[model samples]
Target chain A: MQDSTATNARDAGRAAQRAAEARPVRIAIDAMGGDHGPEVVIPGAAMALQRHPQMRFVIYGDAAQVEPLLDGHPALKAASAFTHTDVSIKMDEKPSQALRLGRYKSSMWRAIQAVRDDEADACLSAGNTGALMAMSMFCLKTMPQVERPAIAAIWPTVRGESIVLDVGASIGADASHYVNLAVLGAAMARIVFDMERPGVGLLNVGREEIKGIEAVKEAGRTLREANLPNLDYRGFVEGDDIGKGTVDVVVTEGFTGNIALKTAEGTAKQIGEYLRSAMGRTWRAKLGYLLARPAFDALRAKMDPSRANGGVFLGLEGVVIKSHGGADVKGVAAAIDIAYDMAHYQLMRTIRDMLDETPIATAS
Target chain B: MQDSTATNARDAGRAAQRAAEARPVRIAIDAMGGDHGPEVVIPGAAMALQRHPQMRFVIYGDAAQVEPLLDGHPALKAASAFTHTDVSIKMDEKPSQALRLGRYKSSMWRAIQAVRDDEADACLSAGNTGALMAMSMFCLKTMPQVERPAIAAIWPTVRGESIVLDVGASIGADASHYVNLAVLGAAMARIVFDMERPGVGLLNVGREEIKGIEAVKEAGRTLREANLPNLDYRGFVEGDDIGKGTVDVVVTEGFTGNIALKTAEGTAKQIGEYLRSAMGRTWRAKLGYLLARPAFDALRAKMDPSRANGGVFLGLEGVVIKSHGGADVKGVAAAIDIAYDMAHYQLMRTIRDMLDETPIATAS
Candidate 1:
């Protein structure tokens, strides 16, 4: 497992495709995951296959339930190898219950195990995040310096895209944890944005006069002073800075990060609703909506959550991508796309090397 | 001091206007405050005076700087009484430093002091928020049960409006503090919504599988179990609920609350930018924009921050309204309008009575 740091994402993608002609990148997917289960997951893999022609999938689920769905998509059927599993983890099952009962027996566990066993480059699941996370951490242990695995989401910003991490993996972070998140997020930014060094910032309250949470401030102080190997630490950024793409990586403790992420999403949906309701007010406006519907559709497509579907479980020994349970085939494909790209670029190797090379100290 | 808790805001407004015919509502304005100094504040006061005909102002600042601006507006000059002060608090001044240097000397300090000294029914400032809070807390003092004062903002929701409190007055709230914020927000909602009982919810991370921050979860549990006076506790709400109008009062500690508030505002601005760029993309889209400009204008008006201008400092013995520092005449007028209504309806007395009557214990 060598570092993929020498090449950028585009160059890596070209190299991966060239390698793909020789030995295809294998991805294990939890087929019985998410709301639509095999219905979306099957077609989604086929859709992803079109994007990555030299990719293979290890599908884990009840064969009786999965085989017929695979039969519908001959392209996916050719690319996939199905594993028979009797048990499927429920979406609402507690992490403890899933660990106690399902363990390595369930489809979700087996998919993650494919990564741990080095049979597959990565695993993708559209299931309950907590269960997926627990199973991933248990099956694929975290890297040496990593204490807790974080969920990194791809955020759409004014400057295109940025990576935000620790979006509710585990709560309460120290300066070290914040620094760890920064390194991991920046690494992902390189893999995704094709940048060698990515700018990172710590999230804090925007009030000018008042001090932020002690831990966040401490993290900010440490980041500002420390000479992190690959990360370009830009000190403090506020909640608004996230959408503005003020930095490539916006790092925060799990709790605040989770709240801010969801708040921004909620605000977007709220404004969308306001726009729709306003457009339907009059006949003239309704006609305008029909005439300008293409632009609105383009806007909607840009704002689509499906386009940015995956949440990479960072800090784990193996790569795991979490897809939204409620996501459609398009969304599932998007998640798979991320999982493939991460694996293709060897994102895990890059982050591990960065963390080993430089430990972000709290003081200096 | 009397509690006007018997009637709703509509009836209260009608009665208040009639009472103003008998005795004018006297308000103290920090004329030297905000970005534009007395230029915006003077016209803002005059605009407010037009709405509340019998309202009188005690404008505090340098007489030379204040009187000329007021003189430009004949209506404001007739209703104003000037109190010259040598100092004006800087917009970026620290709360502690403002207290040390500007206390009872600056216009901001004197306005709040006027409220405390019974010279004015309410005090309004468009200066530094932290300094204003410190001065308000220092001069006005907290009510019987409140250990910390909260700044309550009127958030525009799908169902019209809701009150969200502790939007950065102070940070770190206990379970008891959450309950206090709920009670305070609910009381303010009653004044704004014209409803006797307002529903309150504690903001928590939306994830179903994972538990939220201990403080937030504890606050939610406390709010769920406890029965706050004149408040309907709806257990927990996610960040999305702030705009969904899911609850009349959203209770959160200052830190999370402040982040959420700014995040929403930033997202709104971001989306607005997206719309502008997309609409300008093509000639047809521009034509459609022209046709639907009125509807878009209505939506803009609805999303206007100026319309929801003041954040009231609740739990203080006296009413203190903090306006946005960079607000124009219309926005500042909105702040004064809120001050007039709060004073006319005796919001200070209502909160005091509510706190005294119900301490909002952490648990039942």
Candidate 2:
């Protein structure tokens, strides 16, 4: 009976080891990125480790600052491999200037470089978006057939969530750039939503074919003609359609996309302000708010911007996730969660496969 | 004592008559416009007349349909002179097609023509925006020194309201067009908000000078260099700034402005849905909601889109207020209120004066 029990235990141990070996989703982090830097990033990483036990991290920052923060979370400390770097990119620094000054030496660059070197499956940063993009484009380069990279955000909608691409990657995009965005966004949507053929939409002022800018019209025409295999081209979607979750992927040039994203955020904030002021106006209202606090908590959870923190840098050869510069620990953790998921799902391979399947005539 | 009272009464009557003559803000209405047409328009006009007793309307529509509706509102019927037109612009007709078919004979055309011919101070229509803009442009012609007419909306912000221009008037704008928008938007702001020099901001992806498209950057440069007397050019503003009321006038190309407006609407709707679902989840929440119903009602009133219904057609030879096509009676009334306000304040005169004051070198 003892021998049989030992054999069963051995078998269980072997299975656990194999699972651990197979699920190593390594993420490189720029520890000195956001406003709080190591204070938020270290705690965020620790929290992420709790959720994803199999995930590993290569954290880049000044050793003196980051090591002390890591000491607070022993489990994360055990799972992480620390890389020391004294240099850090400034939040206000221009992209071109940052690239010149902090290329190979900065924490931001090294984190991205780790992904390029295949030491880390993905890179996560809450740094200057322009600088990060510049470094990412310079280091990782664009994927085959991609002219420019885009930032794809998981936008919360009435019907769960949708992917919105080019949320401030670059300002202007041509017809083909929009098509590329549609393709890249669809690829991300598939992995994130676990859908084989995600519905892709071009974000425009109106849904009519002749209503938008010439570039958008041309992109729509191209998307309709190609009828890409990996994605379902759903044609034009208006601004309101985004919140309605009318499509799985909303594609647009960065200028409009960025404006739309910020506008939504601002609107959400404005409504929140209204709600607070309304509930505090009278004693009866205050009492009601107190009684319905739990419900409000749930509503708050649904509206929490931190839950939708990460923006994946699409069309790049290596995976990179950008978190908001002002993100708290929870926001940073959410970003890490996205990085882990992307790496675990082999996002690059999926993107490559999808791109290969896309007909070259339509993509260009 | 009886003789003195009689004299006072006679003096009061003459003063009232003079005030009526001075405050004649004639508004021409396309009664066949909007989803419900005369059903909403007649009642809306009656409501506006209740608020502004001196206001008169030249209502244009199929007399058979509109006359009965007008009969229901005795006060509006008394104040308004009905104009019969069997032709009306369809909601779905393309701009060019609507112009071709509806010009000269359509209700929409007659209402705008009234403004151009000096029979009415302003024109109000809730019909197709594209069609209305096309007809207004063709009939009224662009004002001197104006390149393209732009639609300006009164956007509700946490801090009162802000004026956002080019809300789907036209798609693309050059640097000069943006400057035109800023100038035109500021002129409207002066009349609407009663400000001497409204703070104007150019909308962009970032507040930084280097961030946006070239046209926007160029506009910023021109505004700064000119430092026009009628507007306080406050560099650049972002999407979030619009809701925060960072500037009195938010200027952008029509495409982005329209999207921002719709996105805000969608976000507001989304939040309302979330609030409803949250309140319905538990008995406790329901009870709390019941108690706080008044507070929620007040919040609803504050967030009501109807209050901010009018989009003033700026850069036109005459004032034209465009209401949302799907607007209810209350929304239509709000639009009429804007038309009355604009006409009473002599909006076109303000625009002409502001344009004359602008440095020709910078304006061009």
Candidate 3:
């Protein structure tokens, strides 16, 4: 009986080790990229480690700026997997110009380099988006069948969540870029949500086939013609459909996507203020708020900015996540988790495999 | 004493008639437009009459569809200014195609004709925006000084409110269109906010000079060169600034503006849901809600959709206010009030004067 128990324990230990090795993932974080910089990023990193002990992190930025914030956290300090880069990409700097001028010194560039060099599995930043995209493209290069790298963010919706691509990656996009966005967004939905066949919708002024600008019309034709497998072409979707989660992925040019993102953020803030005031109006309303408080709390948690912090820069040779510059500790932690997930899933490898099987057409 | 009283009453009556004659303003409404068609429009028209008895209205669309809704409203029926066109524009129809096919038969066309023939001072529609814009331009024609008419909407901001132009007017806009939007948006701010010098911000990705697309760059240069009087060309503004309301007017292409507008609406809905959930989380939170009810109610009123329903389509030959398709009675009332105010202020005449004085220089 003793011999049988010992054999079972040994088998369980071996299985655990194998599982850990199979899912080995490391995330490189830009520790000095956000508005609050090291203060927010360090605590976020520590919290992420507590939540996901198996996940490894490389802290990139000024060591002097980051170390003091770490205090005596042994996992952050003594972990052989962690390291630092001594530079940062400023939020106000012109992305292209900064990339050209500060290529060697910028933390953003180094982080991408780490991912490219296989020093880290994925790179994450809360820095200038343009700088990050430019650096990532320059360092890691685009994936095998991709044209432009798109910044994709997953937005929570009524039905579920949908990924919006080219959020601010390529501005003034042509038909081909949008097609690539659709492809990348589909790939992301597959990995993120385990959605085998994701619905792709072209963002437009109206849902009708004939509505929208010339670019949208041309893009729609290209998307339909591509006939990508595991990509259900759902046609056009308007602004309202985004929150309604009518489609799994929404594709558009960076310019439109950026404006859409900002507008959503602004509107959310306004609505939150309004609702708080509404709940405070009368005794009966106040009582109703008490009765419905649990449901409301659950809904608020779903919509919290911290819960949706990280956005992936897709179509690159390596995985890269960008967090909002104004992210708090919780937001940073969320971004780290997203990066860990992308790395563990081997998102880039999956993208490469998919592209390898698919033939590349000339600009769609 | 009786004779003296009679003389005074007669004098007052004549004074009132003279006041009315001095400010004769007429407005044309597409009575057959919107989901409920004449049902909402007729009541809105009656409400307008109650608010602004001095003005005149020309109701365009099938008389049968509109007249039934106005039954028993003697004041509305007695208004000889009301004229009907026996046609309608369908919401689902393609704007460009419909405009061409139903050029003479559509109510939108007839409303534009009223403005062209000087039968109405301005025209309003809660119908298909593209159809309205196409018909308006076709019949009334672009004002000689204006390049392309843009649509402008008032978006609520933290500081107050800001005007966003080219909501969906010119889809494939160049630098010149953006410059025109800036001028139109600035002019709107001056009239609407009674500002002698309104600040205009070119909506872009970042505040830096080289951050935006080529069109935005060129528009920024053009705006700087024009140096219009009472215009504070404040260069570029990021997305967050839209809600901050640091600038009185924000100019962008219709594609970007539409996305921004829709995003704001979606975000607001999301935030409202979040806040409601948060308030319902705990017993203490519910108790606090009761105490803070009045203040919350005030905020809700300020952010209510009814108060922010209408957005004026600027640069057209006449006034046209677009209401939300999902607008309720209160929203419709708000839109009518906006139309009434525009007519009373002679907004179109002010725009015409401004355009007449400005040179037709290419916007960089």
Candidate 4:
């Protein structure tokens, strides 16, 4: 018994040493962000650390508020584990104005700054989306040849998953901006979906070239002219195609993208509510529900928004991810994982390199 | 007993006559327009007629195809109950070009022409939406003082229901178009929801007046200046508000509105699939599904596109309802009913009077 105990201790120590030598990837999280703030953010960071011990986190917020949430987590206190930056960004303020006014002390601003200063590899926030985009653009700046930055969100589709660009970053953009969005989205799909050459589709009212407004027609022409290498430009796609996943990347202006994202969310919730009500109405249905419980749980797990928490603001100088404001701890953890994945993929460097080689012409 | 039976028959016939006299409104249906042609459209029209025997229908399509579908339906074939016009519109042609090229022979064009000739009160179609909008615009022209036409769709919500305007009519409209949509939508809500003063919200990326593209912001200002008496101008609303029923009427340009509507449909389908899968994975969930089946069915029935088949194109001089191309018999029935309602409310006349009172000032 004594010999076995000694062997176990030694093995544990060796495992610890190997983990320490792995050099944990640093992620900067806006702790004072989101509706729930540090209460949700800190625990999520701790949870992520528990799952990925090789990931180090820089929590940017009021240390006083965040430290209390880490009270009993010993692993979070390790030398190579956690760090905190005292700052935060308000959820209600105008994004551009907030970034300009609270440059130094705001948690969103500080998180982006950490990535720029090389203190952290990537930044994640669940704060004001506008403010985060503004800060990311001002601090890290856009990629060398990119016209404007775009936010890309993963839409849960029936076939699998698809990426929608410019969910709520730059509004009223021209055709050039849409072309940039397609390129950036393609880069994201390559990293996220492991596709060498991603299929790109321009979101329009209809599949026909003459169907949509002038902007969509112009964007289609620009995308064709750009002749992006790793992007297979599929002509045009309607709203239903977003879920069909026929195209890997769907590009549109921020206004349309934001509306599409929110509408999808609202419709999902409505349908779920409808199903619940339908199943509750009859005894025979109740029996069917019992027989189908496991499948239902599996479906719920697959569709859970918490599993798909992070949205990346692409075409910027650094890796910046935005989580939903209403996200819980599980969602925050998922966002952290996304930030890690982005860092592992070296997203910023890849975008910068791609932009350097291709000089995208701005629409006059 | 013989005398009583004769008296009862006479009383029933008298009651039917009273109902018919009370139902003064008539709706024109383009029966040969949809994918299913008269097979589905005739049955749907019959269903509507059965529900409201007083309602008269003017069927326009291929008489050979429509007549067989109504063979055994005595009431549908009654001379006082039905009128038929033989013509057809192909689905693939461009709406404007189709209207200009085929107006003399097309069933859809003739249906709208009938409304103009005062033979029918309103026109409904399950054919191409673009063609319907174009034909209505050309045949009816814009309301005396309106600048552009818009489309409005009633979307079901958790709380109740909300109206979204400019679904796909006026693709590249200016600020004035959005304001017109708001005014038109508010008028619709007053009739549909029976609200004396409907709350109108301008759809934007954010709730702030300063947010959104230049067109939206400019429209917001125009809406404010209009000071519509029966409109409670709610400043701004996001996409989530569509299903939340936060406001009675939501106004946006055609581009954003079309995307939002399609996204909602896609997401509802996705959520339904997710729930089905989840229910199949576990015994407990399967049982729960059985218990909840009736409630789920009810919810689905409410959210089903088939139940809400038709959308009204507003700001035109006459009523033009567009039904989903994939609509089945049941969907066709609902669309016919919607057409009846529009005519009953004198929706076109109401819009014309409103516009005439407040003549739209066209910007040079």
- Report clashes for each candidate as comma-separated counts: 1, 0, 12, 46
What RMSD does each model have against the real structure? 5.1, 9.6, 9.6, 10.9
Backbone clashes, candidate 3: 12
- The order by descending DockQ is 2, 1, 4, 3
Judged by lDDT against the true structure, how good is candidate 4? 0.76
- DockQ of each model against the real complex? 0.61, 0.65, 0.30, 0.43
Which is the winner by TM-score between candidate 1 and candidate 3?
A: 1
Candidate 4's TM-score reads 0.89
| A335 Cα displacement, candidate 2 (Å) | 0.6
Candidate 2 residue-wise lDDT at B250: 99
Of all native A–B interface contacts, model 4 reproduces a fraction of 0.76
Q: DockQ score for model 4, please?
A: 0.43
Which is the leading candidate under lDDT?
Answer: 2
Per-residue CA lDDT of model 4 for B18-68, tens digit only, reads 443465767777877778877887788888888778777777777777777
Which ten residues in a row are the worst by lDDT in model 2 chain B?
Answer: B1-10
lDDT of 1 by residue, B1-364 (tens): 1234323433443454455446778999999889999989999999999999899999899888888887799988888888899999999888899999999799999999988777788999999998999988888777656768899999988778889888887777777788788878888888888887789888876634147767667766666665665778887778888888899999888887887788788788888888988888988888888888889999999899999999998988778999999899999999999998898887865665465446344221
Please list the residue runs of candidate 1 whose C-alpha ends up more than 4 Å from where it truly belongs after superposition.
Answer: A1-22, A207-210, A361-364, B1-22, B207-210, B359-364
Q: Model 1 chain B — which ten-residue stretch has the worst lDDT?
A: B1-10
Model 4 misplaced stretches (Cα beyond 4 Å): A1-23, A79-87, A225-227, A280-291, A356-364, B1-23, B79-87, B281-291, B356-364
Best model number under TM-score: 2
Better candidate number, 1 or 3, judged by lDDT: 1
